[model samples]
Target chain A: MAQIEIRDLGIDYRKPKSNEVFSAVDSVDLSVEKGEFVTIVGSSGCGKSTLLMAVAGLVDLTRGSIEIDGKRVDGPGPDRAVVFQEASLLPWRSVRGNVKFGLEMQRWSGGDLNERAMQMIRLVGLGRFSDYHPHQLSGGMRQRVNIARALAVDPEVLLMDEPFGALDAQTREIMGTELLRIWERAKKTALFVTHDIDEAIFLADKIVVMGRNPGHIKEVIKVDLPRPRNESILDSDAFHELRKRLRAHLAEDMSSMQLVQEVA
Target chain B: MIAEFFYRRQALVLGTLSMIGIVVFWQIAVDTGFINPFFISTPSQVAAEFKVQFEDGSVATNVAATLYCFVWSLGLAALVGTILGMLAGWFADVESALEPFIWFKYSAPTVAFYPLFVAGLGYGTPTIIAIAFLFALTPIYANTLSGIKNTDRDLARAARSFGARPLDIFLRVALPGSVPVMMAGLRLGVGRALTGVVVAELFGANAGLGYAITYYGQLMQTTKMMVSIVIVIALGVLLTQILSFLETRTDSWRVDSGR
Candidate 1:
């Protein structure tokens, strides 16, 4: 059975005086099986992040409900953990304290929160900076802590919004592989949002392609590729084909957008 | 290091030069008999009177009394105002309810209504201190509320997503964010308190520097009056400068506009 359900999800973004009343995520229906990684790929401003936030109960849905385990999600709960693009670690908190923050919120007692925090910090390979504050670490290390903090809750669903999109090409590749390794160990149902086609192909068990300007799901492609995926997978025929397909689909949209803008 | 020292030295030199010029003209006016010696004494004569006053211990007692009022009033005002300000900032109802009453207290010329405070708190240094306390509280309360309200919402949201509880967010984030603005209010409050103390003493006190100057002037003791006036001016300037220095030191992260 699917862990989440997004049905007839039409979102209208109404700002004060602007005449644009376009639906950001238009009548989108998507679901996640118990332990699957689903990636939503689109151009910038295509409401991919909006869709993920809706599922995490961060973004208010204009006309739909997102359900988790037969229960409707009305607000953000500890059951779903989200990692944002910029790795929003609380500036004053040490990495260790940040991981423990969520657990402490649920009133988890005594030394248990400490042990769990330490365990997760070690898992993310940020044990060295456990005592260090967020401002002390580099961007990549901060995002790792963000991932660790989310996982510390032992959440049923993990929502990642461009978690590695800020990194350089090499660092991005390394973190992506590391993310999968951690996800495999933790084994949580995940919904990831990204603008990169190759990234969506590399990390996802299923990839949902999004179209811009009142964003709607253009295609949902099943990856069907074997995992415990490594660097060599990028050179494989199956990997190349999936990448090419998503890339071609996005490229056509980009050209059409340019043409339309020029005409208008 | 040498350049920084030179810069400070130049600033001292420029300021001292102007003060010396003013004193020189005043002395010349008295020495040349342009102003009667009985009405306007020279700086040298005031220095001589200061030595006599110091030996008699009247100057020491008066200085001590004035300092006492300045400190006592300022301390209570800061303590009370901060508590009220934090309450006002945190709760909307408290802010709206207390705002108009506070505005009336702040806007009123405190000197015009000195009799009320005198009637309530009574005479000597205590009355002076109460005046300073009332004078200093408003700006601190208002600025503290403004500072807390103006804190960056983005930074707050980031902290919220990390699962920090309400109290933790306030203590760790909100308070630190408010430090730069709070320092501004504190500087103004301390200055206003010192001014209030002097005004109170001038109006009603029996044993302060303000009382000594007025008492001496009325008796035509021009040298003694000059000395007392110098001390009063110095006391106000010294207190303001010290508080400002401490303000910059405590919250040095703000951009130094030097205004």
Candidate 2:
């Protein structure tokens, strides 16, 4: 059975002033088997993050259902953990404290909790700076701690929404490499969302391309590139061909979206 | 060595020198008959009165009474104001309910209502404490409301996504997140609370530093009146310093944010 199953899920939020309901995610059906790495790529308003939020049980489903490990999700649960784009570590908490946050929320106790948190911190290569607060660290280091916090829960599904969106290009690539290395060991079912096509291709086993106006999946392309993927893959003919394909799909959607906008 | 000390501590040196200069100038003016000693007490005369009041222990008693009223009223106001403000900030209905009264309390002359408090509480320490509490509550309530309202939505959402219950999110995130601004509110409340205690004591009570000031002034004992006024001023400076120290320590995380 798939670790996560979303069957025809929809999310509608009411506009505060207009009192009109707008659909953010419409009829989105996807499933992730255990230990699979999936990425959703789209434009700004494509509802990709909203879809991820629904899967994490942080948003109300307007239609259908989300099942995690064969159980319908009611609200946020210990089985799923989310990593945010801004690396929202509590400013007052040190690196170790931030990593321990999810475990603490899950009512984890004993010395093993500390052991698990420290191990994740070390996995992310933040061992030397465990005692430092979020504000003291660089942006990339903070995102590493953010990843560590999500991973510490030993969740069945790890949902991430542009987790490295704020980092510089160079730092983003380094963190991406580190993330893949970390995933090699922990191998939890991962669903990542980003607009950067290179990032989606590099990190994902299968990339789900989404389109905006009412937000639904457009295509699901399998990334057949071999792993362990490194910077060398960027120069390969196969990698270039795949990147070209993804770009064409996205550009076609963008032009068609602009045409619809002009008519409306 | 003296120059080095003076250079390193310019503010302390300048403040001490200015105070000494004023005292010397005032004493010279009175002794030379430029000002009447009976009407305007010299520094030495005020010092003598302070010594006499200290010897008789009236000064200590008055200080204790004022300190008691200030501490109790401010402490209670801090607790009540923060809880109410957190609720108002967290829930829209609570905020709406409090909006009108908060505006009224903030804008009205709270000291003018001291008579009503004295009428109900029967003119004693309780009345003074009540007056201080009423005066101090507005700033704390306003700041705490804003603090909680302005807490990072991302952090709260992140906590929620981690299976944190509402109560845990409040206790662990909202409360700590709002603390720096709440401390700022408490600092503002300290000044208003001092005013409250003085107004109530002067009008209704026979004890406290405020009463002592009025008592000495009515008797035309200019030196003792000056002493009491000095004590109040000293107390204000001391309390403000203590609160500032505490605020800095509590918000040590803000050092990196440069807030």
Q: Which ten residues in a row have the lowest lDDT in candidate 1 chain A?
A: A102-111
Regions of model 2 farther than 4 Å from truth:
A109-111, A256-264, B1-40, B255-259
Writing each residue's lDDT as its tens digit, candidate 2 over A1-264 gives: 888888998899999999999999898989888998999998878899999998888899999999988999879998899999764788888899899988888887546877898999999999999999888889999999999999998888899999999999999999899999999889888999999989999998999999877999989989889989898888889878878988987887788666666557
Pairs clashing in candidate 1? none
lDDT of 2 at A243: 87
lDDT of 2 by residue, B72-180 (tens): 9999999899889999988879999999988888688887787788679888899999989989998999899998888788998999989899888888788898888
User: Poorest 10 consecutive residues of model 2 chain A by lDDT?
Assistant: A255-264
lDDT value, residue A114 of candidate 2: 74
lDDT of 2 at A237: 91
- Return the top candidate by TM-score: 2
Docking class of 1: incorrect
For candidate 2, the chain B TM-score comes to 0.91
Q: What lDDT score is found at residue B209 in candidate 1?
A: 83
